[model samples]
Target: MELTFASYNIHKAVGLDGRRDPDRIMSVLREVDADIIALQEADRRFGARASVLPRALLDDTRWRPLPVAKRPRSLGWHGNALLVRRDIKCLHAEPLDLPTLEPRGAVLAELDLRGEHIRVLGAHLDLSGLRRRDQIKAILKQCTRRGKMPTVIMGDFNQWGRLTGAMQVFGMGWQQITPGASYPSARPIARFDRIIATPDWSYETSGVHHSATSAAASDHLPVWASLRTA
Candidate 1:
């Protein structure tokens, strides 16, 4: 089976116009139209850490978020959230704490799609290079602890170029799918957003989801990949 997965940093649902419009973010998501989506900065930075994209609004969408929130108001842990198609069955979901100077975490989920079990990890790593490598090791450890399956780890990696420090840690065991420059949605010069998968899956196509609405929705444009079992 072939499935499309996307990773987006919604910038807390704030656009380049300096407007906080959750609807616009939804519009971009619709345009991407991926089967699964990994979101960074989906929740507010402070206070209750409530989600910028309200749960009520997402109710109208085709995607359902994994129940991995730590707080009643938060959508996911540490601004990282995972969303899968409404038909997908969530087998297991957990929040992971990353080693960082600031509040940084990752979300993990096991889903059953037509009796096919798979894993998804959503993360937004730190700005510091050192912290990012540490975060990757932590995430890698989690992946190793889980049973082998078709897995995808995606989010705003915050890495500037293609072959960078943190990505190197993932090494040859995993395949990195960079859909090109996805940051600064207006111009998209840096590839901050990315998707990584194990050898169990092979990619069909991948690219940045750029459009009029997407460019206005957030600082980082969404990156997507089409993949099937190897």
Candidate 2:
């Protein structure tokens, strides 16, 4: 099976124009229209971690956010959320807490798409280099405890080097997709956002979502990839 996956750091719906427009964020999402989306900074950092994307507005779409939020008003855990096609069945969902100085964590969602189980980890690591390494190790350790399957981890990794920093943890069996620079959407020069899949999946096409709206929607442009089952 082939599917398209996207990772976007919405900056909590705050645009470069100094506006928090959830509608504009939604519009950008519609433009990408990926099968599975992993979003970072989807909710406010404080005050109940309230979702930036209106639930009512999302309900109208073919996609649905997984029930991984700890709070009723929050759409994700630690500002990380997963949105999958409504047709895909959710098998399990949980939050993965990382060792960090601030509020930081990840979400793991196991989904069933036409009987094939796919595991996805949506995470936003800390900015501190040391913390990011520890966070990546923790994420990998957690995945090791779970049953093996075709897995993908996507988010704003916040790591600058493509293969020199925290990304070094994903040694073998994992293939990291570099969809090009996605940070500083206006004139992106950093690949902060990423999508990594197990060897069971092969990449077909991948790139940054550079639509006019996306360029200004947030600080980071969305990255997407088309992958096929091996």
Candidate 3:
């Protein structure tokens, strides 16, 4: 089976124009038109954690947000969320505990995409390089505890270099699919946003989803991959 997957950090819908516009974010999503999308900073960083993008807006699309335990107003777990096409079957969704100096964590799902089951994890790792390494260790440990399946993990890594040590952690059973620069969408030079598929799968093609709207939508451009199970 083949799937189009994307990961984005919406920066709470605050764009280059310094406006908080959910509609702009929606436009970017519509342009990507991915089967699965991982989002970071979908909720406000303070207070009740109100979602920047309303549920109604998401409802209007063909996508459904993964059901995870969170505050009624919160869009995701620690600002990490997953969206799957309405036709995709969500077997389970859960929040992951990650050690961070700042509030940060991961969300994962076991989804049945037309009978092909796979685990998809979405995360925004901490900025501190050391903490990022520990967070990756925790995530990998959780993947081991969870039942095995072809997996796709994507999100803002906050790492500037491709040779960063933190990335080495994913080398065990994952293959980097999209390494194109995604940060600062207007002039991306760091590949902060990425998509990695389990070794059991391969990518047909992958790259950063860039456009005029996406550049104005957030600080980070969404990265995507066309992946297929082995």
Candidate 4:
């Protein structure tokens, strides 16, 4: 089975110049055209403010948003979210809690695509090294417990190009699909986002998307890969 997956830190659906524009985000996603999207910092505040990428942005006949958190005034409904195409049967969403000064969580989803089961995990780690290290340990534990299913883990890891945590994850079974330099979309200097997969999936370096729309939509550019079941 062929799969298209993407990981993007929407920056709460805001642009580099601090403009909140959910439509731009939707446009970028529409251009990406991924089957499954693992999104980080998907702001969905209920009372505090309106959602930039509200439910109305997606066609009800083709997509669904997996719930991650209730709208909170303190954080303004900030959390991770998974958006899957309607053809993919979503079996479950497993939420992983990590330690951080800021609230952080991971969404693990099981999708049945053309009779094949695919596991996709999305996360946004903390900025601090100590907190990121602890979060990495928790993620590794979760991966070990999940055993070997066709897995794709992607999100804003918050690690720069020189960080060892990102390299350590790649040292494990996960392959980093995005090239170096992906943060600060206007002038990307570090690779703080990624899409990783296990050996059960074979992905070419060819179809990674880092277009100008991405740079305009958020502080971090959306990264994606086209993969085929190996």
Best by lDDT: 2
Residue-wise lDDT of candidate 2 within 1-230, one digit each (tens)? Answer: 99999999999999999999999999999999999999999999988889999999999897999988999999999999999999999999998889999999999999998999999999999989889999999988988889788999999998888887888989876898989998899999999899999998988999899999999899999999999989
Clashing pairs in model 3, backbone N/Cα/C closer than 3 A: none
RMSD of 1: 0.8
Please, what are the lDDT tens digits per residue for candidate 4 over residues 108-188?
877788788888888888888778878867876887787767888888888875437534645756666655577778888
lDDT of each: 0.93, 0.93, 0.89, 0.74
lDDT of candidate 1 at residue 210, scale 0 to 100: 89
Q: Each model's TM-score, in the order given?
A: 0.98, 0.98, 0.97, 0.86
Clashes of 2: 0
Find the 10 residues in a row with the least total lDDT in model 1: 158-167
lDDT of 3 by residue, 5-121 (tens): 999999999999999999999999999999999999999988998889899999899899997638889879989999999999999899888998889989989998778899999
lDDT of 3 at 23: 98
Candidate 2: list runs displaced more than 4 Å.
Answer: none
lDDT of 2: 0.93
* lDDT for each residue of candidate 1 in 1-230, tens digit (9 for 90 to 100): 89999999999999999999999999999999999999999999999999999989889999989999999999999999998999999999999999999999999999998899999999999999999999999998998898788899999988886777878998888989999998788887898889999999988999998899999899999999999988
Count of clashing pairs, candidate 4: 0
